[model samples]
Target: MNRKQIAVVTGAHSGLGKEFVKLLTEDGTISEIWAIARNKEKLDQLISEFGNRVRVFSLDLSDRTSFSVIEKLFLEERIHITYLINNAGFAKFCSYDDITVDESLNMIDLNVSAVVALGLICIPYMKKGSHIINIASQASFFPLPYQNIYSSTKAFVSNYTRALNVELKNKGITAIAVCPGWMKTGLFDRGTIGADRATNNFSGMVTPDVVAAKALSDAKKGKDISIYGLPVKLTWLFSKVTPPKLMMRIWLMQQGIKP
Candidate 1:
């Protein structure tokens, strides 16, 4: 019998990560899955629920030292990673005045730096048909008012993923970015800001399961970028025609926040 293809997804404990884990495990295409997250108990529960198909890896994406541990696993394990999904990130909402240097730096560390580092670390181990999917935000298409830092980080992720796709294409490694709009995940509820605002304006929000399914399907098709939801698509289109300053002003006004 042929060995099942291996897939690795970070942030597997909750939100879209959990959905991805569930979908991929049930998909007959995947043979093995490495569910990486910081929560050991949740990982254990996921493994128990999914049975022997899923392997739990206690990973904290923001930790620079964690790469070495992952590296050790890649080298020692005989599995070929068919897919890598960088889905681990946190959301912080604060105006520039209220945002601290440490908070801003942490956002960059987790959302941008760690993602790039993970891609680089996984590249050497990735086989020819391997694919990498980075979970960015629809905020990448426009400037968000209270969520400035998080939005900017996602913008960077989206751009970086596209640029990297070109470089890896010749080698048969596909890199794609998934840009999803406001998702009904615990991210906002557990965030430092924007939870109340998001709840009040939840009409356009998409479920995490929907987003994850679309992302996986897009990645499998080798799509360069996947932007989820109609409102987000319209916002992205508007950003293309509108000037940066004007767009920022309009977005802030819509959010009832000042530019």
Candidate 2:
């Protein structure tokens, strides 16, 4: 029996993840796409929209136990994993004092831990030409004041994915860190609760579709990082030349936050 060529995407129910799923389904090389998210209803809806090509896995990536569940399936199905998109993450727009410790930790768990865990579990099933695209943010470029924990988590993701790509080169596997600007997704709905000044400025926000398209193109080119939009690209360049303290100060001022 031949192993199926499948793509595994976390947070695949909607937003950027959903766009990725839609693109993957059209990929002639991909036999199936495993859509993983916390919402079963939304996952089921994906199957309806994309047909049997989309496999639903309603698992919360933040929970460590979820890795075990995914691992078990990998063992049983013996699928050839072509792509792993670690896109399941959240952000909160508020001061550090306003965020509970649990919220901060959960952000770490889902954004950082989930990416690491999924990479370890899926790498064995992947071969050359396989891609791992982790959705980071332009926020990763700086230490945000009000969006503190979220920025920190994305920074870890951006750096970690780049380093991981370096390590995976021996196997010809490509890892891409997608750093896009503000996206008008469901993320903002939860992120803006008791929103502070940071939420006021959503500059150069793009839709998930644009980000997803560029990510796929960059992955094919074997680029280590995919940054969509000219504004976001400029931000990445700006962060590199500027000092960390200065960058933080700039960000705080841009958001009208008091440092």
Model 2 TM-score on a 0 to 1 scale: 0.97
Report the Cα lDDT for residue 173, model 1.
Answer: 91
**Each prediction's TM-score versus the true structure:** 0.91, 0.97
Expressed as tens digits, the lDDT of each residue in 162-231 for candidate 2 is 9999999999999999999989799988888775565568888889999999999999999999999888
Q: What is candidate 2's local distance difference test score?
A: 0.92
**Cα lDDT of model 1 by residue, 153-248, tens digit:** 999999999999999988889999998888878787656564433213334788999998888888778888987788988888988999888987
lDDT of each: 0.82, 0.92
Model 1 RMSD to the real structure?
2.4
- Compared with the true structure, the alpha-carbon lDDT of candidate 1 equals 0.82
Residue pairs in collision within model 1: none
